[model samples]
Target: MIGARVRQFRTARGLTMSELADRAGVAKSYLSAIERDLQTNPSIQFIEKIANVLDVDINALLKDEAATNSSDETAALDEEWQKLIAEAMESGVSKEEFKDFLEYNKWKLKQK
Candidate 1:
């Protein structure tokens, strides 16, 4: 739930509910209600304020746990691919050279 995610991040950052509410410029009681799931629907403006104070994207707070986990896994894979590309660039692999390699690999797969 959005509330749970919010609480998770807030606690992880060692922020008390009052502190988070104060930083987000929201009412402390309203924030408590949100964290406790007594209030489930918060306005986008409300979410934006909390998200900003938490330093997290609004999507992170809104996504389901499963979707968030998948997104996290995908992000890790993307980071790995980015590092590999950086290594290739550092090794002086030109864009044209990489394009040729891709074309050749495609053709080789077609031949099989």
Candidate 2:
């Protein structure tokens, strides 16, 4: 199931298995095994790498397609927000720090 989802997203993005593997820093053979369902239960970190490269939410890769649909506008907005959050996470910004920043921003907006 996860393998099919990975393949679907990868193809949808016009990325070959080799390209996806290279970009995600994953072994191509491992990625192939994943797509072929020879390897189930990939680590979260591996999924995260693929999701980052695919510019998709992790849930999209984990959940069934029927359950993942939304308005195009919402999907686009969510994709952008996911990218931003991923960037913050990669830069070592803790969730608490992100919440603090959001709270600060809310307070600043209230002052206007």
Candidate 3:
């Protein structure tokens, strides 16, 4: 579950394992295991360490495999983004505007 979540979050952020490992100050191989579920029973502290570096709550990475793991907060964030994008579309915002928005947000995140 955590592996899937890690892979999902990493991919969503457009980061490779090595990139994330560098950001998180962890081993790429270890991160790989975390993504593959081969290391299923990683400790809570281990999970917390990774979560802290990722800027995601540990609970987001600790769901049952059978469940889809978007917490209410994450879902709310997504809904807000969707609404903004939809409003932009209705207002005829150009693709350039969207690209700029995404790039700006990504850059802002990097500043953290």
Total clashes in model 1, counting residue pairs 3 or more apart in sequence or in different chains: 0
**lDDT string, candidate 3, 14-101, tens digits:** 5678888888777899889988988888878778777876557887788753345457677657546645654666578988988998
Q: Which lDDT tens digits does candidate 2 get at residues 1-38? A: 89988987776656789999999999999999999999
**Minimal lDDT window, size 10, model 3:** 63-72
Task: List runs of model 3 lying over 4 Å from the truth.
Answer: 65-112
lDDT of 1 by residue, 1-112 (tens): 7888788767656678989999999999998899899999999999999999877789978886545455777755744664566567658998999999999999999999
Cα lDDT for residue 19, candidate 1: 90
> What's the TM-score of every candidate structure?
0.59, 0.59, 0.56
Report the Cα lDDT for residue 54, model 3: 58
lDDT for each candidate structure: 0.82, 0.85, 0.74
